[model samples]
Target: MTIISTEPQLMPFFSDAFLEKTARKCGFMERLRNIGPQSLVLSLIAALSKGNCTSIADLHRQFNGMCLSEKHTVAYKPFHNQLRKSAFADFMKTRVTFAMVQLIENVLPPLPKKFEQFDDILLQDGSSFNVHPDLAGFFPVASAH
Candidate 1:
């Protein structure tokens, strides 16, 4: 069985450090130390592939699905449930805050120059987006119970 979903294999553009640093700063380190940030990102990527980015409920479903998966880190010992529990809900709230900051950091590129010529136009600025809050799980379950 292909336990490790294909999303991680497919999306090679994502940066590991970004997720790690963001996750750590946000306090996901304790909850996902052994699983690591990359796995969390990978699982999140896999689950979010099934839903729309703009839907708030979709985020809930994706994380729940991934956490329930045997391959996901939470499966071995499902401590928190952002969907059906309060503790997890608070935890998720913090995660969401950090994730949003990380996301914005990712999409908006850093300012390149201190100044630009007025007469001589310099074309600058590009757009990038990975619009899924659900891309925040470890692996996935080998089988759903």
Candidate 2:
């Protein structure tokens, strides 16, 4: 069982530049320049990494521990409003992908000490359903070959 740390220490791989690069790749910061100077995306992710932010208030508390500058201070309501924006959702999806890739790269499951042999058996409920040829495109199956 792997015990992941709940500490809010910023990892080197998930640095500001790394996240900024991802944000840029995902077009989270594509257009106009009149927005706030703070990197809310980084703040949000860092806060979430700490395992403390379950609600708006908790997020606000996490901001301080995330090492955000005083100038980057953002209230819960405004942050929540930004989160509700569609653009933020896209950014989050990209972040999720990055995290998944990192996990896959870093985590290796332990090998069994001794291989166990077991009989192969297949069991299924006695039921079948018909599929229309026209619907094959929507429900494609693997080729038997």
Candidate 3:
């Protein structure tokens, strides 16, 4: 598995200018404020990269901690309000699409001849193991022991 660092490496994919433009396009940035698109996106990326973020409250704290300055810190209510908006979903979808496109274009190689017939290839792990008796109805085993 490849691990992407959250610092200078992520900057290429989410530059300040790109974040600003996309936020405006997605209606995520209705007005300039302490929690700008760049800061929010960078904070989210950093927090997620660390693998400790479990909830929106965690993200809110991460955002304040990573802000450019003290003046940029935002209260949890305002931060949660921003996230509850529909624009937030659109913004995240747009960013994920952009990142996927960038990964395919720059990092991934072209498909081989054997797979030319397929437009896309999705890989899934098929390994399975026994589960607790309580979950047997939910996740049936391949064969009884």
Candidate 4:
């Protein structure tokens, strides 16, 4: 059962202090303008929800409906294009995953894979596609033998 709320509540609970601290440490505040570090977080979440999403029109209709603060609202085709097309998603995911790897690498007890230092290398991967039914045509294929 889904209940509706009139109040614009926060979906992912994050603290302003936490964001400010991380922003200063990671130097994200240098590049981001107008919006806060948490804005990047919200956009990242929007982008993920926008899987198979192409074009900013889709992004606006999809993410803008969410309960974001007016300042957090994303607009302009350029913003969506920049978020989905640029290396932003990959970069964010890489940073987060790498941090987790570094943390859990030594902690959280050990597992069978932990013993395999030979394959200790960690890999991060990403992909995207369009919602268009004819999207497969966009994929490249090498000539068959």
Candidate 5:
């Protein structure tokens, strides 16, 4: 069987300096240096995306595999507890969303001139939505309610 690597690929969008700046701004970094906030965030993303890591134990395993040095390791409970904090949760959500937007902006091709006429373009994916009662005259419902 071919071995698959779960190590972080060092994404261009998530640079070390960028993550560090975000972590510092969010107050995730204090005095200790071994397990930096950036490493924790990157490891979490890599584990969930690559190894299909589930429980805190699996998180530890995935993180350990990505580590270059074997000197220090973050325990599962501490890592879990840290992630549970509201501040960290908000920070991760904002940063991840920002990263995704940046990635799309960088990789996606520019829109055609016809589409570019609009100030904004929203692309949503879901089942058809019901029309408001105000527009019932214009658009009748397909099925009887």
Candidate 6:
């Protein structure tokens, strides 16, 4: 598939060295094992891009499928455990931040004079939802008595 071909293009943006460094910095990598940080990150990106991977199990399958050999394939539990770590979020955040910085520096043009003063521009949908009464203790809401 084109997925295999496109991976080489992505390597320039998300290099193996950078992925390993960030993973180590974020405490996601203690020591390199069967499932390296690069493999995990690339597999995740590829799986998500396909849009068919709806669960962790699906992701696990995709990871194994991407492996070059049977020996490199990880078990479902180990794969799940790797992603369950608290540092997983930090690891992903670092990667995303790096990518965004790279895009801003190399790809995107400079902002106009008026907008240049702002560090970042944020847009949010002003959507709100009511929590169930039973969840009030867990999710407290502000009220005007």
Residue 98 of model 1, lDDT score: 56
**Which window of 10 residues has the lowest lDDT sum in candidate 4?**
1-10
The parts of candidate 6 lying over 4 Å away from their true place are 1-12, 106-108, 112-145
Query: Which pairs clash in the backbone of model 2?
Result: none
- What are the per-residue Cα lDDT tens digits for candidate 4 across 1-145? 1224311222223446665565555544445554455655655567667587675566555555553567556666645555554345554555566455654555466656756766565554423433444554565341110
lDDT of 5 by residue, 15-119 (tens): 777777776777765554666666777788888987566687877777777788777776777767777777787668768787667556645788898997799
Off by over 4 Å in 1: 1-13, 52-76, 79-145
Per-residue lDDT tens digits of candidate 6, residues 19-55? 8888899999989999898889889999999978899
Ranking by lDDT: 6, 3, 5, 2, 4, 1
Could you say which candidate leads in lDDT?
6
Q: Name the best candidate (by TM-score).
A: 6
- When sorted by TM-score, best at the front, the candidate numbers are 6, 3, 5, 2, 4, 1
My TM-score estimates for the predictions, one after another, are: 0.32, 0.48, 0.66, 0.39, 0.61, 0.68
Candidate lDDT (C-alpha), each: 0.49, 0.57, 0.80, 0.52, 0.68, 0.81
lDDT of 4 at 121: 55
In model 6, how large is the Cα lDDT of residue 102?
49
**How would you encode candidate 3's per-residue C-alpha lDDT over 1-145 as one tens digit per residue?**
2456334444556787888888889998878888888788888888898898899999999999887778878999999998898999999898988777655565668778899999878875655555678877777654353
* TM-score of structure candidate 2: 0.48
What's each prediction's clash count?
8, 0, 0, 0, 0, 0
| Candidate 4 ranges beyond 4 A from true positions | 1-15, 31-33, 60-63, 67-74, 77-95, 98-145
Q: What residue pairs are clashing in model 6? A: none
